[model samples]
Target: MSFDSFLSQIKSKASELKTDVLKFKNKDFLNAAMAGSALIAMADGSVSAEEKQKMLKFIEGNEALSVFSTSDVIKAFSDFIGQLEFDKDIGEAKAYQALGKMKNNVEAARLLIRMIIAIAAADGSFDVTEKKVAQKIAQELGLNPADFEL
Candidate 1:
């Protein structure tokens, strides 16, 4: 191959590596975001298509989470949903555990709360059940639900 071609290849590979590294560093945050999304989506005992779309949109738009592919986000969300389906108490516990990881990062926690609220309202009706779940998620992240108008 030409030297320029080789250089281009290397730069492409480096960019891919950088993206991978960013995804790894933000994995915890991704999981936490998905967990919160799942909890709110399932709050009313039914996960709506709009709710799922809202989550994907948020992840695609968010700088920190944009590095992750849609499949990765879906898998994380599915894992939380599967756990909840198998056992509500256990699933909720696991979700809360994931959220608790961000308890100390006040900025991230606040952002998470906002994202959760958006997901809950994605159906165009943020009901009491979803509000309660959002509140619980804020609490898990050591945030104030009222701050997000939950």
Candidate 2:
């Protein structure tokens, strides 16, 4: 397909996906995932290209979230990072709330929590700020601290 056609196709798919995500009642899970991913990307005060790639890869590969289109995944990450750029506390609060929404599905919740921990540890070492954020995320998931020990 021509580049224009490709772009058009993507836009159409994105619109459809947007509707799907909007219909999702689990805004908290989406928000939490977005917030955690953003925090992981921005833990060092800036988001790196490599970190962004890792987050995209993880979200794309996640089975539980297979319903999310690549564009939606990208959109959520972008939303999270953009929020962080404006205010850290607000971003963290959003992520914390998102995590809180995924408490019922134990496995899904744990998977997200584990992914958040992994993302935080991706850039070599998990800093105090990252750990604290991860802990908060874990609490939102209603998981034990021992599960993702500092």
Against the true structure, candidate 2 has what lDDT? 0.70
Q: What is the C-alpha lDDT profile of model 2 across 14-40, one tens digit per residue?
A: 465445444452646566667777876
Give the alpha carbon lDDT tens digit for every residue of 1-150 in model 1: 999999998667546544543644588888898899888878877656775666667655554455678788879988998798789899999999999998998877877776577556655789888888988898889887888887
The alpha-carbon deviation from the true structure for residue 79 of candidate 2, after best TM-score superposition, in angstroms, is: 0.3
Best by TM-score: 1
CA RMSD of all predictions = 10.2, 9.9
TM-score of 1: 0.73
What lDDT score goes with residue 69 in model 2? 69
* Residue 93 shift from truth in candidate 1, angstroms: 0.4
Off by over 4 Å in 2: 1-28, 61-67, 123-128
Q: Looking at model 1, report the run of 10 residues with the lowest lDDT sum.
A: 16-25
